[model samples]
Target: MWEMAPPKGSRLFQTLGRRPVLRAGYAVVIGVLVLSVVEAYRIQVSLSGQHEEIYRRYVDEEEHINTLRRNLWQAGNFVRDFFIRSTPEQAQTLRSQLQTLQAEDADVLQHLAQMSPPSPVPPGVVKSLREFWAVLDPVPITMLHASNEEQYDFIQREIVPRRGELYAAMLDLSDADKQRLRDYDRQFAESNGRAAERLLAMLGLGVLLSLVVAAFSLRHAETLEQQADRHYAEVEEAKRELQQLSGRLLEIEEEGRRRLSRELHDEIGQTLALLQIQISNALAALQGQPSGPREQLERARSLAERTVQTIRNISVLLRPALLDDLGLVPALQFQLEDFQRRSGIACEFVEESVADYLPDPVKTCIYRVVQEALHNCEKHSGSSNVRVTVRQRPGSLEAEVADNGCGFQLNAKGMPDQSRGLGLLGIRERVALAGGSLEIDSSPGRGTRIALRLPLEAQPQPAPRVAAEVPA
Candidate 1:
């Protein structure tokens, strides 16, 4: 026989990768359903056990109460027969047996009280017991002092009748107790049955809800899986486009830098040099001439030297030569030293295994970030001391720059002109490009601390060498 095929466009046709979140949600819902089922089963078992206990107690109490009533009736019959006997000795023997029977009845009543039955014995039962006790107590004393047949006749006529009445009342009391026990048992059964029914209903509802939730979760998972596939495809495409755009942007930036560097070097550099040469020539020509001419040439030479120096500073600010020639640490050291000297701020530098661990691009990013931070500190913070630290750990690199300066409120927004507060933004972007995070902590009148953490690529380990056999 041929195997049946699944319907078209069914869930089975979809791949597992299509909906991870929905699958997770469905798993959670199924777990909750299983727990509910287990809990319901437990409650059902517990109620069943309770029902058995209540049933047993009801039966036992009913039997005990009935037996007590029958015994009391028998004691009444014995007393009546003794009173009707012609011999005093026979009466004495019956009275002793009757006393024993009465003690047994009292014990039973006490036991009943101890049981603390759910329902109390009826008021009629209590009244009957009191009457029986009154009759019995008086008869034991009166029988001992009784003289002859007259006393015996008195016992038969008066005490016997009262004893019969007391016995009947005790029987009625026992019957009332039995009725109460039966009623209590019925109520208990009804209450237990109702509780079980409610529990079952709750369990059924819980199961139904679970099933509904499971179904919804399954359907939702399928939809989410489809959405995830679309999102993944979009993300991959975006990533590729972003990579291409970044490369193009880097190329454009490099070209622009080269053009600017060339212009500064060829135009401004040559002009300044020419101006210096011309001034020197004029100075040489004015030797031993008028004081004014000599002074003018000297002043011109001085101005030309200052112009040359200013141009060099601007070029370095645009792009540092050391950064291009050397590595990041060396470049940062040079920049920090220059800042310290110019600003007359005491700045210390510290490093830990960072020189060999960081990639060149990451190093450049971190260096630039630190450079901007320091510049901001010098311009804004009235700080006297600064400390820069660089360290490397197992998975990342870290750098911090702290300043003992009059810090400003860091939570404040940018200045009115957007151009006035791009320093921190630039630092943040540089760190982000290097796959790092930046945090700034500062308070008014306190110092400012800037921290950077960058993720590092895992270094490949060397292959193990095979051991060579030694000559034996």
Candidate 2:
């Protein structure tokens, strides 16, 4: 059956949604947006500065042009008055004034050219300036040589009319320049305003987006923290349950062992003892009988001894009494000796330092690890020589069990036998629990060496009080 997918707004939708490559996207987007806004703002500032400079230049140019126009008008009036009544000296002075006005006009034109030129001046202004310069160029010489009336008539008729046309053209050009500048100023102002508004809007959006992202991140963090707390609680509960189960299992196993031990010691042990005593009585009774009967009695006595030894072996197999009575070293020694005697294997046991510093569990774990390694050697490798070394250093205790055996392949799935592999796994776990480490090295046709290192620091527990004896 075809199943419908969850809707986009559903919680399941988000959980099943494609993972966002959001952070990188956000960084790229924000960076580009910020750069663009900054660039726009920078351009706006630069253009605004340019606008102000252009406006200032235009103002200065217009003022100079106006001053030139006024000077030219005064020169024309001075020539008119001098020609009408004054001497040739006054007329020559007026001509000098006209020369000064022309020079001033040239200076103003040069200043305007250096500044930002407005759109091209009208054709009429150019024509007027050319014609006015043509008329005035000969006027200086004419004023110097001609009669005052002739000079006055020349200035009033030709120079005055042409100067008026030049002045009007100059004013028109200045107004056109001012109009063009005003248009540029308005365009620049509008562009700057629009850019600033956009930059501000983008900044506001960026801040809002940042706030949203932060809030979402904070909420996610809180959710994660709550999840962590819940997981911790669950783990603690599981641990408590595991501890209870382990304790219960250990108690049951110990109880069963005690019952079995008691049954062996009380019932089977007594029966064996009674059988030995009966065999002795039979041997004694047969002492005066035939030699054949005496030999039978001997056979019976041997059988009883064998049976007793077998029972003892069974009891030892169930639990080693030496482990409880004499502690770890003695128990280990007994086991090694028994292994050598039974297997006829060459074995060496070396102890570097004898320190009663290890806890029982650690000792047991190490002993078992050695036992498993030796068993593997005997069963699988048929190794003849085994060496067990124990050393107690300042900070740690170390043990190694090595055998000159044909080692088997060690794969990731672990040792060949699953149950047997547990021995190594258990050894590792036990060492780790004791804050230690274990290493195993082996290869086919080489040998197997199991090394274990355990911290010397004992598990923290209340110290036992020593008994003080009274003077007797």
Candidate 3:
């Protein structure tokens, strides 16, 4: 079966499309340059042919005109000799030359009829040739009849003057033809010059286009290199951030261990020791005087209850049960109350609930951030009042903490001085881990405010609420 071939134009286009852009551009430019060269050469050849033809024609006409002038001059000389000599022998010789002159004149006329005149032959010159022939027609006939004196007078007076006039006309025509030939030569020179100029322009344009293409390619490569460098720099920065995060986490862990050890050793261990002494005293009292042991027993029981409460408070600080059970609102309220009692800083909570259900991670993140913010304000701000607000927007939650306290300048890293601590850094990292953002605003002698936003989409919704507010 004969399959239909694809169209030639489509096939050519497809072949060009598959080539590299630079290669294709070069091909197109080279093709155009080649075409320009060929056209210039063709035009030059054509112009040269035309100029040569004009020059050849002018040469032929000039030569023929010179021959005609020579014949006319020779015929005038022969007649002059015949008229002046007045001898039979001289007369016979003159007659023979005259006959030869007649034959030459006939040949000149025949040549003129056969050949085209040169360009720029003046109309006056053509009329002069006709008059010269008319004047010559009577010359030999008059010579045969006239005596020597009469013939001499006629040759000198009429034939010589007529020949002079004809010669002058032919010379003028020849000069005109020469000038016209020079014009054609000049025109050919100008055309050649123009062709050279056009060829140079085409080559220059092609080179300029190539430079432009090369410049664009170089610029594009530079841009790609810059992008690659930027990407590598970003990767290095991320690695540095991970390292810093790891170090900070280790520091936080160590601090927690020290705090727990102190709590266990000083508070829990002392309370247990004191309870053991109280129990021992109550047992002794019961053994010795049962009647008076009730008061001692009651005091020991109260001390034991206080120790239990202390442990509970520490556990709540670690991870509040209210956060898991009652949700973010109640947990925040409980934390604020505790913060007020411990720091002597009056604290308030405000909520704008956009959605009722809050994810556990989001709730925990917010609660921890708030706790840290309050702690920082208590420790660094020296403030007596603190306000915390949590607002719910579509798909996200925003929390802001502001304190009426003496604020200090933060370092370039946005961390307070080492004497103050790394509490803000901890909060920032925590917020980041929760896929949120944190902003701190503080100035010297002014109050500090920290705002954070956490995305709620990652949280699993368990309930919903419109709004909630807590008073200081």
Candidate 4:
């Protein structure tokens, strides 16, 4: 006997059940597709509601502004009509219109107050409107009872000026609202555009993933690995280019500092030095003369000396020639001495037996880092005691600048802060370019310590100096 055949639906289910992986995959794909459709509908509805609400608010605000304009226009007209009318009936009619205008003005103010919460209307505009209304509300009746000369003076002094002010305020409010509405349009469009892009990307990724799983999972995985490797290589290449660009920028900056320092030292420093010497010579010539001339000479000499000292300090800050002429240690010592003298903040510099021949870049970086750190300490850290230490190891150099002053939170994310400034960031970049790492330790009311560790192997050899030929 032949067995009864199963139903067509049951047979299909049995076939699907035979391949559990395929059944699961189909279910997942269907579920994702349904979810995508539902999400799209929901997003569209949401965007539509937001768009309508924005437009509705925009329309309401625009109407309120138009009403304000109309109110000012009618007010001016009713004021003139009350003055122009001769008969009692005409005056009474104009008076009624003025009263109606005043009522509408109150309504407009109420509307403005309500609109202000949702619109961009400024409170100043509302205040100006109220002020104008206070001047305008009694003008019609007052003009009706006034003589011709009195009405003319009132129009010139109050009505004309106040009306102009109200018009100006309304114009400003209208323009501001229009700008805000345009911005809203742009923001909404951009938001929806981003959402659409993300949705499309997800749908496309899902479809591709489904197709890949159905066909070749292993091949897809291999392809993904290849793509990831390619991306990583591209990223690494970009990073290298960025690093090279940063290094070049740093080199150009140092060269600029060197040029500026030379100019300040050679030009301005010489000028002030010459002035001091001249003042001294003049004083010698005027010695044993009148007391007045001698006192004037002394003041001139004192000013010249102060000017010379200022020029010297500026030259050092711009770029210290000692770093290039002598070494890093001398430059740092000079800086600490200057800082101590100027700020009255005690400073100490400690050093180990550093190698005599250090790369110019390394020397510059080290000097600049210490200088900026000290500057920060002087400006921000109200600490009385600051210490700078440098040590040379077998293969590396380490330096730390510590302050006993008030410290700040060490921000790792590098958010911009004007109070903290870019000194720390600049130091960090300089150290990184030198194949070094920088560490900052600080807390409020405690102290700050900045440690720099640079690799010795990365330091390039200094270029050989050529002796100038002596004249025969």
Off by over 4 Å in 4: 1-212, 216-232, 287-299, 411-421, 458-472
Cα lDDT, model 2, residue 456: 66
Model 4 residue 445 CA deviation (Å) reads: 3.4
1-472 in candidate 2: lDDT tens per residue?
9989755434532664322523643675587577767877687778878888878877776787777678667766766666565566765676787677778767766666565444355557656766676676555455555786677578678886788777877778688778878888888888778877777777777777677556555655676799999999999999877766764664466456556765776688779889889989988877778899888778887887888777777766555556556655566677788888888888887776545446655565566677777776777777888888876666776889898888766777444456456667656655565567888888889988889887766544333323221110
Of candidates 4 and 1, the better by TM-score: 4
Better by lDDT, candidate 3 or 1: 3
Model 4 scores a C-alpha lDDT of: 0.78
Backbone collision tally, model 3: 4
lDDT of 4 at 136: 66
| CA-RMSD of model 1 | 14.3
Q: Provide TM-scores for the models.
A: 0.44, 0.56, 0.46, 0.49
- Residue lDDT tens for model 4, 248-343: 998998899899889988998898889889988998898779989889989998998888888777778888889888887778888888888889
lDDT of 3 by residue, 230-344 (tens): 9999998997799678657745764574467556646785777677677767767677565556676767777776776676677577666677667777888889998898888
Q: What TM-score does model 3 achieve against the real structure?
A: 0.46
Point out the worst 10-residue segment of candidate 4 by lDDT.
463-472
| Collision count of model 2 | 0
After TM-score superposition, what is the CA distance of residue 121 in candidate 1 from its true location, in Å? 44
RMSD of each: 14.3, 10.3, 13.0, 37.9
Ranked by lDDT, top first: 4, 3, 2, 1
lDDT for each candidate structure = 0.69, 0.69, 0.74, 0.78
Kindly report the root-mean-square deviation of model 3 from the true structure over all alpha carbons: 13.0
